[model samples]
Target: MEFLWTSFEIVGTIAFAISGALVGVSRRMDIFGMLVLALATAIGGGIVRDILVGHFPPNSLQTGFYVLLTLAVTIAVFMVYRSKQDHHMSTRWVRRIYLTADTIGLASFTVTGTSVGVYAYPQYPIFCMILGILTAVGGGMIRDVLAQRVPSVLREEVYALPAIIGSAVYYVFGYDGAWLYASYGSFITVFLIRTAAIRYEWSLPRVY
Candidate 1:
């Protein structure tokens, strides 16, 4: 289970980095800036998660491999995307790819954070759940801040809500047997909900 969780974390990091790189590409950022953004988005959430849990040095820091992986993924994504523009791919296709990658990263990281919190510190379920939500969305929040745009998590389209709900479900089901099943189910639920919300243009009603 630990190995599985770690695998998910690494994949999630790569996915998020790719998403960040895509955003950078869209913004016409240079290669160096793209790499920087990707690295920040990939590792920011994990760093915050560790700090919140008092895990100094942070797994993202200790594992140099993760940094290398983020760099490699970013470069690869940038290269592929840059080349495709010359071939005249539609802007809509590029946007779809970015959004899809972002959603996957959001779901995967949410599960990873929640699972880690549940396994490592089951006594504080609420804190763990919040950490999970933060870990899932924190990178994008930072990216949006750096990019001078409104963070998507703050909007009504069932974005952060799905992460919160998934994290809570992970905590609840994780208490029983079949932790992996529960965690994966929660992740899929969040992903599907977010995807549906995007596709159907669903939004939470504002009381104001």
Candidate 2:
């Protein structure tokens, strides 16, 4: 169980780092700025969750491994995008890659966050779902705010709904130590919903 949880966290972190760094590069941020953006987008939610759960210092800052990993991924993204941004980056391929990374990050982080909630506060299932959704989307919200854009969750996109739904489903059916498969199922649900929203421009109805 411990190994599986760690695996999910690592996967989510790597995916978030890639997506965050892509945002920085897309925004034309410098290397340092990119690092900052990546840090916020990759582990901001985990930090928030730790604080809320009374897990002081947060896991991201614990052994410094998360920071180092985020830093390395951002650096790689910086190098790649620096050379390509002005030349061939306008293709559909670039857009698809960014969307793909974001979708993956969303799914993996949702599971990891919910897992923490389940193990930490099993008695309060609602809190587990809340933490899961927050952990999945909080970093991206921070990233967007830093970039001076509206957070996607608050936008018309059906972003948070999928995470929310997945969290609730996981809390109801998963969360048992025997349900690693349940976590994966929730992950896939969120990923597919978000990806389809992007691919089809699905959004909630607006009052305007």
lDDT tens per residue, model 1, 1-208: 7787787788789888988887788788998888887877888888889898899899987969889999999889877776664534577887787788888888888988888788778899888789889999999888887877788788546889889988988888886757788678878988998889999999777888
TM-score, one value per model:
0.94, 0.93
Q: List the candidate 1 regions with Cα displacement exceeding 4 Å.
A: 85-88
Q: What lDDT would candidate 2 get against the real structure? A: 0.84
RMSD of each: 1.5, 1.6
Candidate 2's residue-wise lDDT over 1-208, tens digit each? 7887788788888888988888887787889888998899999978877877899889888999999999999888877766774546465777787778878888888888888888878889889988989999999999999988888788747888889888877776665665577588888999989988888988787799
User: How many residue pairs clash in each candidate at the backbone level?
Assistant: 0, 0
lDDT of each: 0.84, 0.84
